[model samples]
Target: MDGGFVYGGSGLSTIDGKGRCTIPSDLRSTVEASSNGNVVCLARHPDLPCLMGFGTTERDALVTDLKKQWEYAQQRGENFDRQAAGGPLASSLTVIGFEASGRFVVPPMLRFFGKLEEQAFFHGNITNFYIWNPSILLAQETGFEMQKEIAEYFLAEAERKRK
Candidate 1:
């Protein structure tokens, strides 16, 4: 979350028949460093039609932020349901382990939620990265111009490779 392990760069990967895809090299190295291993925590974006991926450190930061929010609400005499606040965050994330080669399985629910098909586009956001179904990303009408352009470029590149 600070000086180390910033998620940056973007790439595209093809989903294999078994619902597995390889994380791009630059992103994968940062994930390994931040998590101290080959595990990545994945969850559906709370507001988007994509999957969010991060390491343990980012996950810890999210938990700490939630606690701070609860305390602030308590100080204001507002009733904070900690369980309700944390339920979606806790239940949505799934821990996935990748091989050293950076290949990992995509959980079926996440895959469906993300609308992933043959290809996924990866985009970095410093603390985390988004895994997008390329067409779905391009279909987004608001914001994400840079991400959409990148996804389009990758989709073009993949098409070129096939011919």
Candidate 2:
């Protein structure tokens, strides 16, 4: 799939008890443009610090890639130590699907990570995204920027955006 979808900048949004957040207008546009109007939320685990929102096309491509990698490893007799490593991105991912209306749910554990008090930010991470609490993003003191190579490496919506 063509990842030419331009990632709009990040913005603040609120989360409800059910963990739903409204897609920022620009983000919606970015999602609509690339996804042909559909989007999905992805989480590595409820214990993770951030969440990812992805376009369906990217999601599918990632799943396919992951499965291929897993298969190759299996064929090569990659050891249990190696098998203990990575799996299908789907296996690595947990997600919430969304409708065209622009509201999506975050997993309960993810919501707890930020003590999510209604506001969060959606930052693009090239192949995926970061759904973060505003305070968490601000609390970071590291001079390093995440995904420095993301924008150049792929059709990332925003590779990584930080203050």
Candidate 3:
């Protein structure tokens, strides 16, 4: 699959010395459904060290949504525009073919970002696939929960202020 798509899930797999990792057998069927495994996009997401996966279908739709959102932000003002534009995102990975062995070549930059080694987590996040170092994934999960606590604190404060 090499177009816009959407999917999300957790499937355990390992990356070989050659930087190839396999999708779980169950997931393989989904990949096969795509034109070319839907050109899996594995990338890091904001506030998480985990990998996010998107099928080719979701990926294309995301771009459209982002563009619309960006435009809406611009209408709001420079502050909104700045917020949307001030981030480095890895949304431009291409789908490299998979081997008969079921291993796929992950990009070097993505590999480093993911800190991938022998074992990694493969996630299908509806717009792409994310490859994450398992430890990083754990840390990310913990950090996200902590962030929710902080956000709750702020929300409570806002409620008090409103009163």
- Candidate 1 lDDT over residue span 27-99, tens digit each: 9998998898999999988889999999988888888888999999989999888888878767789989999
lDDT of 2 at 34: 62
Model 1, which residues run further than 4 Å from truth? none
Candidate 1 has its poorest 10 consecutive residues by lDDT at 1-10
Tens digit of per-residue lDDT, candidate 2, span 48-77: 455666677666666566677777878898
Model 1 TM: 0.94
Tell me each candidate's TM-score: 0.94, 0.63, 0.62
Rank candidates, lDDT, best first.
1, 2, 3
- Per-residue CA lDDT of model 3 for 1-163, tens digit only, reads 3353344444556578788777654445455555355345555566455555544555465566667787886787744453344344445345556654446777776677667777666555454556667555555534445434433454456458669
Query: In candidate 2, which residue ranges exceed 4 Å CA deviation?
Result: 1-6, 45-48, 71-77, 80-101, 113-115, 143-163
RMSD of 3: 12.5
lDDT of 3: 0.56
| True-vs-predicted CA distance for residue 22, candidate 3, Å | 0.8
* CA lDDT, candidate 2, residue 77: 86
Q: List, in order, the clash count of every candidate structure.
A: 0, 2, 25
